[model samples]
Target chain A: METSSPRPRAERARQVADVLRQRITAGAFDDGPLPDEHTLGTQLGATRNAVREALGLLRAEGLVERRQGVGTLVVHPKYGHGLDRLVGLAEALDGYGDVVNEVRSVGIVTPPPATAERLGLVPGAPAVHLERLRRLGGVPLSLDTTYLTADIGVPLLDHDLAGRDLFALIEETSGRRLGRADVVVHAVTAGPDTAALLDVAPGTAVFALDRLTHLDDGRPVDAETLHIRADRLTLRATLHRGPA
Target chain B: METSSPRPRAERARQVADVLRQRITAGAFDDGPLPDEHTLGTQLGATRNAVREALGLLRAEGLVERRQGVGTLVVHPKYGHGLDRLVGLAEALDGYGDVVNEVRSVGIVTPPPATAERLGLVPGAPAVHLERLRRLGGVPLSLDTTYLTADIGVPLLDHDLAGRDLFALIEETSGRRLGRADVVVHAVTAGPDTAALLDVAPGTAVFALDRLTHLDDGRPVDAETLHIRADRLTLRATLHRGPA
Candidate 1:
C-alpha cells in the first residue's frame, strides 16, 4: 500500500507494531517469554531505545504484554458478551441496598416530537411522562423518564408511583406478560433536566440508555430513557472475533 | 392479581400496553397498524386521555410509531453492528473527512501506572508517550495518546511522520499481521489537555474509547486511549436476540 504522511512518532510506533504482529501471527514465538530489551535490540540490529519504543506501540495496540520478570507474552482475543441474557440490570444493581426514588414529576401530556416519531403516532398524541430521580443508598445514580400511551392502564393516575414495580403492575392489571426488549446506548452529558434531577453539576458525563420493550406476541409495550452516572455504572460486553 | 393501589392513570396505560404487546408478540398485530386512540380507548374501557398516555410509554421504548394520516403502527427492532470490523484508522478518518493531527508531545518516557498495569509491565518501564490531536478534516475530533515500549521501534524517532500510516509501517518493518482488538467505551468530559487539542471549551462532552490489541497467538501488543467528540461519533453494536 502506498504510504500517506503520518506523524513521525505514529510512523515509528506503527513500524514496531508491524514487526511484532508478524512474529506473533506467524507463530514465530510461543505465548511465553519475550526477549528482553537488550536481546531484542541486538537481535533486531536496532538500539534498545528503538526496540523499547516499538514495544510501547505494541502495548498501545494490545499486542504484547511485559511481565515484571516473565518478559513480554502473547495473549488471546476476547469475545463479546451476548445480549440474550435478558437479565443484566437487576444483576448489576444487585446487592446495592435501598435505591432512593425521587419522583420528579408525573403528568399526562402529548408526546414530544421524537417520541411521537418513534411511536408512529400523530403529533401531540396524548401521553404520560413520568420523570424520576433514582438513587442507590441515597446517592443519586440516574435520572430516568418513561412515556406511555395513556389508555393502557387508565387506572394508574391516582396511585403513588414514587415506589412500585412498573412491570408488575401491568401484568396484574391487564394479564399481559412482559417479554423482550430492544435497547440503544450512547454517551451524553447531563442536560438541564437530568442535571437538576440527579443533583449533579450540568455537563456531567452520563450513559444514556434508550429501550423499547415488547411482549411475547411481538407487540411493542414500553419505551424508557435512562441517564446514568458514568462513574457508577460499568458497561461490559463479551465479543467474538471473526475471519481471523 | 389483586390491586395494590388505585393509580388509575398508571394502570390504564399499563393495561393498554399489555394488550398491544401481547397482540404484537402473538402476530395478531403484524408490526403494522395500531388501533387509533379512540378505538383503543373504548376497548380498554378508558378515556382517550388514558390511551394517549399509554402510547407515549410505548413510543419512549421505540416500539410504536404514529403517522399523520396513517395512525399508529408497531415498529421493528434495530439490528446490531459488530465491532469486529477492525476498521482502518485511515478509513475511519476518511469517514469523518476532517481528521487533523496535532502532535501534543512526542518524546520518550516511562510508562504510567494504568498503562503499565494493562500491559503487565512495571511502572516507569521505558516507553514513549506520543500524545496527538486527531481531527476530521479541519474540525477537532479527538485527543489520542499512544505509548510504545522502548527498544521496539526507536527507528521511528529519526523519521518525519507528518502523514504516515503507522500500522503499515509496523507491518512492513516487523512483518507482523494486525490482529483482533478489545474496546471499552464510556462517556466522559474533556480534561484540560484534550480540551485544548479538540478546540472545544474545557469540560465539553467526549466519548472515550480504551482499546487493547493482541496477536493471533494471543500476545498483548498495544493499548491506546482515544478521546472523541461525543456528538460527532457514534459507536454502534448489533445485538442478536438468540432463538427462542
Candidate 2:
C-alpha cells in the first residue's frame, strides 16, 4: 500500500476529517447541525484542536459550512454516477429528480475526419449533430454534444428529445441493441460559453467526458462530448483485478 | 441525437478544430510545426477563416502554440489510465516510465471510523497506515494514503516498499488473491500543502479518488485515498450496457 507523510498532528486531523466527511455524506448530520467541537472530539477520541482542524478541512472541501449562530451544517453532497455500467444520465440519476433536456440544435453536417472514422463513415459523409443542455431539478448539470451516423440520426430529429435519453432514442430508431462504450474522463476549466451554459463561474473546474458508443455487433454508432458540473457529480466504479 | 446550438460559423470552426486535435494527438505533427493555415484549409476542405478559428481554439485548449515565425506545435498529451482494471500505479503506467515510490511513512495506527468499517475492523482497532508519494519519470503524480488490516499489513513492513506495488506485496504476504475494488472519483482544487508536494500551483484542479479493496471472499481489506494531478492523467473505461 502506498502511504502519505506521517506528520502526527496533521494525520490525526486528517483521520478525523475523513470520519466526519463519511458521516456528512452518509447523512449522519442531515437532520441537524454538527455537534460542538469539544463534543465531536470526545466522540471521535481526538483533541479539541484536532476536531477544529478537521472541521476546517471539511469546510475547505465545501462539504460543510459554519454560520454565525447556526453552527456547522452539511452541504448537499454530490451524486455518484456509476461508471462500471453504460447508462444514460437520466437512468443513472433515477430517483434523484426529473432530468429535463433543453435541445439546443439538431442538423445534418459533414463530421470532422476523426469523428467520421470513429463512426466508420466516409470522410466527408454527412452525420446528424445534436446539442443539449441538461438539467436536474432545474439546475444546469451538463452540456452534451453528440454525433450520429445519418441512418439513425435523421429519424431522431422527429422524435421527442426533451424528456428522453439519446441512448433510448438511438436504440429505438436503429432497432439495434446497444452494447458497449469507450469513455475517457478528464478535468478542465470551463470556458466562457460553457460556464454560462452550466451556470457556473468562468474557469470553474468541470468534468469532460468523451464517449463512443457501439452496437452489439461492435459497430460504433454514437460519439458524444459532455461537460459536466464537477461540484454536482462523482464517478463511481467497481474494478476487478485480472489474473496475473 | 441531442445536438449543440448551430451558429454555422462557430460550428465550422469547431469541426475543423476537432480534425486538427485528432491529427495532433495521433502524432501527425510530432516531427515539425503544423502546416500553414492555407494548406490545412485546402487539405480539410474548409475555409481559411474556419481553419484560423480552429487553430485559435486548439491554442486555447493548450494543445498547440502559435510561435513567432513558427506554426503550431503539439504539447505533451495526458496519459490515459484504465479505470476498468484494478491495477497499481506502476502497473497501470507500464511503458510510460519508471514509477518510484517515496515511502514517506509506515506504521501502525488507529484508523478513522469509516476506514475501519471499510476494512472490516472494529472502530478503534489498530491498522497499518502507509503513505507514499508516487512519481512517474521523476515527476510527482499522486499522493496516496492507505490503511490495511494489520494481519497482512504488519508483515509488509519488512518488504521492499519503494520498488514494488502494494497489491503484489499483499498477495505474497497474505497468500490470498485480490478481487475487486470500489472507487469514487471527483475533482477538487489542490490545497496549499498538496500543491507544494505535487509541485503545482495552489487551487489547481486535482482528481481525488477514494477506494476500498476486497479479497476474493468479499472481505474488504484496504482503504485508500489518492490525490492525482489532473493535467497528467485521463481515466479511461470500457463499459457494457446490461439487460434493461
TM-score on alpha carbons, each prediction: 0.54, 0.86
A-chain TM-score per prediction? 0.58, 0.83
In Å, residue B52's CA in model 1 sits off its true spot by: 26
What does candidate 1's lDDT look like per residue over B1-244, in tens digits? Answer: 2223235566546445534543443345565687788877755556788778777755543346787888877654222223435543544455334334666667766554445555566765766556666655566656666665554335455554434445444445556665666666556655444555567666656666666655545555556666766544444443333333
The lDDT leader among the candidates is 2
**Candidate 2 vs. true structure, TM-score:** 0.86
Find the 10 residues in a row with the least total lDDT in model 2 chain B: B1-10
Model 1 lDDT tens row, A1-244: 1223345444443334434444453345564667788887654445677677777644533345787868887643221222433333333455655555666657776654445545455676766667666777676777666766565435565664555545555555656666666665555555444555566666666666666655556655555766776644534443333442
lDDT of 2 by residue, A1-244 (tens): 4344446676667657756765665567878899999889877778999899888866766567898899998766577789999999998999999999998877888876667887999878999888888999898888888889988789988898889999988888888889999998866555556667888766566777888999989988898878788767788899998797
Q: Which candidate tops TM-score?
A: 2
Candidate 1 wrongly placed segments (more than 4 Å): A1-88, A98-100, A103-109, A122-128, A148-192, A208-221, A237-241, B1-100, B106-108, B122-125, B148-182, B239-244
